[model samples]
Target: MLKVKNALALISEAAKSWYSSNPFQFSAIIAYYAILSLPALMIIIFNIVGAIWGRDIVQGEILGEISRAIGRETAESIRMMLVDQGNEKTSVFATVVGIGTLIYGSTGVFFQLQTAFDRIWESKQTQTNEILVVIYSRLKSFGFILIIGFLLLISFVLTSLLNTFSKRLHRFLPR
Candidate 1:
């Protein structure tokens, strides 16, 4: 019982520390960057996905959701941007440049998230060179993006299977 009490105390202290770290400030910063970079990030994701799935199908669903959430005008703008980005026929150099820009743009939110998480974990130390820190941060954020992509693929597959099963069940049910 004493050990349980001690563990609780430790957890409470950690929670206090995290809350005192002004996490909301960092959250707002991340949100701002996420909004600013959303188009670029979506462009990169849809292009890669467009290779495997029809881009129009994906974009149509995304636009429908976005319209419901944001509004038709905003969704239309996003749709236009995604279409333009994915439809480009570019030279190798141009393609490389575009992808590089997308990576940098997309990682802004993740980098801010990492900074906030480090503070909450209280693992921040005297940092290394600025360039080195940026490089490491970008690499870490890119890893997060890859994980999200994997999770999204899993989600899509699961949803497809579930939808198919539900449709089959409906067909078998009495009206």
Candidate 2:
């Protein structure tokens, strides 16, 4: 029982050390995966467009049609409509991709936490309870990304406000 207690303590200490040392890694990873989500969004849009138009985008030269649809517009209204639609579609595609990436990437930290606990608790003589305790000990470490993301959002809002304030202050200050 003493050995078990020592093992659990070791695992707890290791988990604490890891989380404290690498607090930002999780946020960085989440951000990286979030950025990569662009491809996923493009693929989704490509499929949706193909389904709606009854054409295989890769083989059918769909962009040509889109270009033509905009080019053939003799009226200003038609040109504006085409341009607006294209822009809207592109924005939707990007948003879908980003959200998809964020959601998928959110699971990565959990898997890492699971692996860390498994390694930390894997004694030849250890029982399941110790392993479970180790896993629970590390679960909070996986939440670093979520916390960082929230903080980043708050910072972004604050930065935007600061930019506005700076602009106003610039008008009052000499160059």
Candidate 3:
């Protein structure tokens, strides 16, 4: 009985803190930035994973799986948005501008999330205006992106192995 009461009290406190933190506004900002950055984020991960397996093979398998799961039209739309072909004749200057936008867009959600954390903790650092702190926060967000890429690559490898094994197993089974 006492433990249950304590647990409820803790949850109540946490909920109160979250409620006071302008959660709706914070989440809206995060969602907006996430939509803007999804393409660039996927492109970065695809490049990292593509480096391990052949790009063409990986992309084909991924697209096939996506199409199977979410219908061909949705998968094709996402592919067109995210995957840039070298033969598209994109301008070098435009590419540079896009890269700059990608970095900023990807970090925007993390910056807003960090601000929310500070609000919840009632953090008031005197040195918050330091340039180093700003750079560190942005790098911290980039580190998260790297971790996500690594995890995605691992998922792709594991799923491919399982798929290959399943096919071989199916051949050995009764019709």
Candidate 4:
């Protein structure tokens, strides 16, 4: 039918546009940033969720999920990396510098994604100040990281409640 042909044509055009965007190059760049950011991102997320759930529990739950997706060996290596990073002790000045670095690293992937999106959309906004723009971009990325942490906390709470409810329901039901 004409409708089916039109639908196929639309899909083909979208695919062509997507391919023209050089998605693989963007993906490689994003992956590189993500690798650099993972440690800082994980530390921030753990701290946020650990405030309520406790660090061990949150870390275990996250690592366990990762283990399921990947493998236990890889998960254990990630745990070791986190532990090694966290165990380091330094002077107050050094600590401040490290924290700043971690924040910058954590926001790298988000900033890169924002750049990629702007390029893909061909967005042009009037620039006021370069420093302010950089600050705003970093702050926006940091806000996104915080939102992710909040959502992870909510997910854990919901999963815990659901498991408890399921157990209680099982007790009441005639198996």
Among these predictions, the greatest lDDT belongs to: 4
Report the number of the highest-TM-score candidate.
4
lDDT order of candidates, top first: 4, 1, 3, 2
- The true-versus-predicted C-alpha distance at residue 134 of model 1, in Å, is 2.1
The TM-score, computed over Cα atoms with residue i paired to residue i, of candidate 4 is 0.88
Which candidate model has the greater lDDT, 1 or 4?
Answer: 4
TM-score of 2: 0.31
Taking the tens digit of each residue's C-alpha lDDT, what string does model 1 give over 1-175? 5698899999999889878998789888989999987876676666655556566766776788899999999999888777665476789999888779889998888898887787877886577688889998998887877776666556666877899999999999977
Could you tell me the TM-score of candidate 3?
A: 0.79
Q: Worst ten-residue run, lDDT, model 2?
A: 53-62
RMSD value for candidate 4: 2.1
Model 3 alpha-carbon miss at residue 42, Å: 1.4
- lDDT for every model? 0.79, 0.51, 0.78, 0.90
lDDT of 3: 0.78
Residue 121 of model 2 has an lDDT of 56
User: How close to the true structure is residue 147 of candidate 1, measured as C-alpha lDDT?
Assistant: 72
What is the alpha-carbon lDDT of model 1 when measured against the actual structure?
0.79
Clashes of each: 0, 0, 0, 0
Model 4, range 35-118, lDDT digits (tens) per residue?
999889998898889988888889899999989999999999988876677576689999899889989999999999998888
What residue pairs clash in candidate 2, if any at all?
A: none
